[model samples]
Target chain A: MKAVAVLPGKPNSVHLREIPQPKLNDQPHAHVCSIPEGRAVLVKTLQIGVDATDREINEALYGNAPPGGEHLVIGHESFGEVLEVGAKVTELKPGDLVSCTVRRPGGSIYDKIGRNDITSEETYYERGINLCHGYMTEMFVDDAEYMVKVPPQLRHLGVLSEPASVCAKAIDQAYLAQHRLQVWSPKRAFVLGAGQIGLLATMMLKLRGLDVYTLATKPGPHRKSEIATAYGATYVSTKQESMHDLAKRVGKP
Target chain B: MKAVAVLPGKPNSVHLREIPQPKLNDQPHAHVCSIPEGRAVLVKTLQIGVDATDREINEALYGNAPPGGEHLVIGHESFGEVLEVGAKVTELKPGDLVSCTVRRPGGSIYDKIGRNDITSEETYYERGINLCHGYMTEMFVDDAEYMVKVPPQLRHLGVLSEPASVCAKAIDQAYLAQHRLQVWSPKRAFVLGAGQIGLLATMMLKLRGLDVYTLATKPGPHRKSEIATAYGATYVSTKQESMHDLAKRVGKP
Candidate 1:
């Protein structure tokens, strides 16, 4: 299968190459075949979202990498469909649609079932980082728990789920969980940056209900900020007026 | 009273000088003047928390503050008693023990009752950031809403509240709110580092029921691992183990 490999862990380190078709065998620790055990599926990739953190990490590390490996398969956000299943596989089967984060699900069923700290207790299921393989390829395998069945409405959003979920969580953290939405909260919020993460943050914040505002540091009238506004923000400028005063005034409503 | 002031923005820009004592004056904001406010009482300071963020920002900006200079009078995160209040202030009275987060009730009563996001907004009320004040001083003011009555069990944990709350928030972010305990099962968690944040992450994960593990880049014993285990974690030397094998074992857990 074809995949992108990081040659030296640098910004320009990516090399597209063919590798041995993933052995779809069902090893005890890995599923070479989709039909391995309890609940898992194999997927053929349709799309994957590239992430900034990925770029940044690669650039920071430059070419230096951990000892044994000189090249690595890159990417995790993926959308695909099952082609087969094992006897124990239940939630998925041939041709079911799916998308999931880089994280995988592992450990005893009991541990998964009982943990109170899912993030901490989560099996180290990163596909692209700190793990054996990832799904930038034509095919891959994933546990059912890592899979999110894309509803028909959201099917268009396929592999975008990883980021959308992240945005959702950030919104939950910054507003909903913090009780930011109350009787008379600010009708507007202005995200100062116009980068990808900032845009995503703005998107989620808007979803939680703020007249979202995005600040364009340089102007081409950033589309990201516009999208943020369309979602709900009221874009602001650092040079226009004091955001502090605006926050005080607009926040009153 | 003595206060550190920044005259300009620079690494070497700080001056510890004596400033006029800030006495209770007729300020439009809430005050604890030992007067009758319905349920709230104003308190004098008993303890204040030191914030590292404050120190850096101060050194960076020579105290050439933006508008709303009054907010800089004192830092947040302190325990104090209600000294005085308007006849309307209630819920706290003088001598009631309380430890407060830097959470500002907000910019105004209109904002508060209206649930305006302004006063409480991170952009508006972020303590120690923006032009907002830090939490190191002889005295400061707080509202009943921003105040959390310290539990008897946590009485001795006074100044630790700020850091503990931060740790609590991170763990909660990583696990609790995101269904860390409910979904995304894990067999083992390898906390990549053994710093304060990492240690706290370990502890929180343990509390949530993960076989917590730690990997430190530096030389050290598993003191953090021990605390994590006490809090609930398994231990491992990240450098000593093969990450792929570790992931395989834990990913399938």
Candidate 2:
């Protein structure tokens, strides 16, 4: 199997390398291979999205190889085709399209609750970013619990689920905060830094019926601002107005 | 007015000092005091809660003195009574019991959207914890928007709101992360450390109908464990089982 990997702590060392293909019913840690592990699926690679985290890992800003390994596989945002499944796997089967979550569970109780993303302890691991092989290979195996199913209508968009999940998490958090005050009905939102995350957040907020405003360094009538406006969001370029002035104009929430 | 303050970068220098009281119509930076700042409210201190952040500030672990000032007031969690309001203040009134939020808005758009708690930039200010004066003083003024009203029934419990808010934020974040799967109904929660935050989290989780378990270093048959049991939550002493074992027993969400 071919995989994209980076030499840990070595900047600009990203390359394609041959790795052993994963085997079904192979339990590296288990004493007996015959023991059935429920909900474990092996996925064949389809698409991998490159984002800022990948760039950082390539730059050796922050990434770690799996224990005893010198290189780390480098892709967390990915779409894949399910090629194999363990005996007890029921949610997914061969030919199913899916997207795998980036961060894997650590030893924390929050991790046990499938909420490792909010684990206060810093022991959590993200695929490709640190201490684990990611889905940037020809194929990978992960617990079916961590994979989200992609519908046939949205197969191409599955690779985008990882980044979109970030926005979803942010909006969910905002609503949770607002839940403190039961009367709060958010009418407006301001998203800074019109990057992928920002634009996705703008789209999410627009979908929620909020008048969205996005601030970015790119001077508009640029494509980014146009996309924001197309989503019924107002776009502002920092070059024209200072953040302080824009915040004042938007006023308090 | 007398307030407890600490000189930044100097450990164990906490002392009481008399600072000038805030004026109703004084605008320190504005060219005119009558510029009609409507949201700012003047609060009279009633109660202040001491937490680890205060200890950190006292030990010079992390805290900043206000700019142009020699020391920073050291209390972020507090309950107070509204003393005065600007022309536009509407949510609160004079003599109203309230709890003022510790963190103040920064230049980020997150701050503008009333979500400064999740502000991405590190420029945000914490009352008494950083560059802003905290609520340990006799009286302090803040924007009416930052104050959470305390009902008469919960007046005595109002001081607990700050610590409770931390737990609230954590649970909110956990739910946000869990929101990825639509059918996720958490059946159990394990709170580690059994401190103020942990206990409060246990209570919140119990309120949400989960079987809550608390892990603490203290031996069982103690007051903390009794409180846990009183809340209908199970208490586990770390002396009996390690965190790793406990997490495995709880299973995955």
Best by TM-score: 2
lDDT of 1 by residue, B1-253 (tens): 6655454355654556565544434222332112123434345666766556556655564232436453343344566555665455566665566776554444465354734323444444444444444445555454456556666566666655666667776565454333422344455667876655677677766777777776665433556656655665655566666567677777644
Candidate 1 per-residue C-alpha lDDT over A1-253 given as tens digits, one digit per residue, 9 for 90 to 100: 7987676545676778797664335331253212335565667788876777457545645223323567656676678877766566677777778886564444545334533113453335356653445667777765565677776666777777777676666555454443423333446566777666677778777666666667764544467646766766766656665667667666544
lDDT for position A116 in model 2: 75
Which tens-of-lDDT digit does each residue in A1-253 have in candidate 2?
8999999899999999999998765542231112246667888999999989899999999898877789999998989999989888888989999999877766566666767777645654778887777778998877777789999899868888999999998788767655543335678898998888999999999999998989998789988999999999999999999889988887765
DockQ of all candidate complexes: 0.08, 0.05
In model 2, state the lDDT of residue A94: 96
The window of 10 residues in a row where model 1 chain B has the poorest summed lDDT is B26-35
User: What is the Å distance of residue A154 in model 1 from its true position?
Assistant: 2.7
User: Residue A221, candidate 2: how far off, in angstroms?
Assistant: 2.2
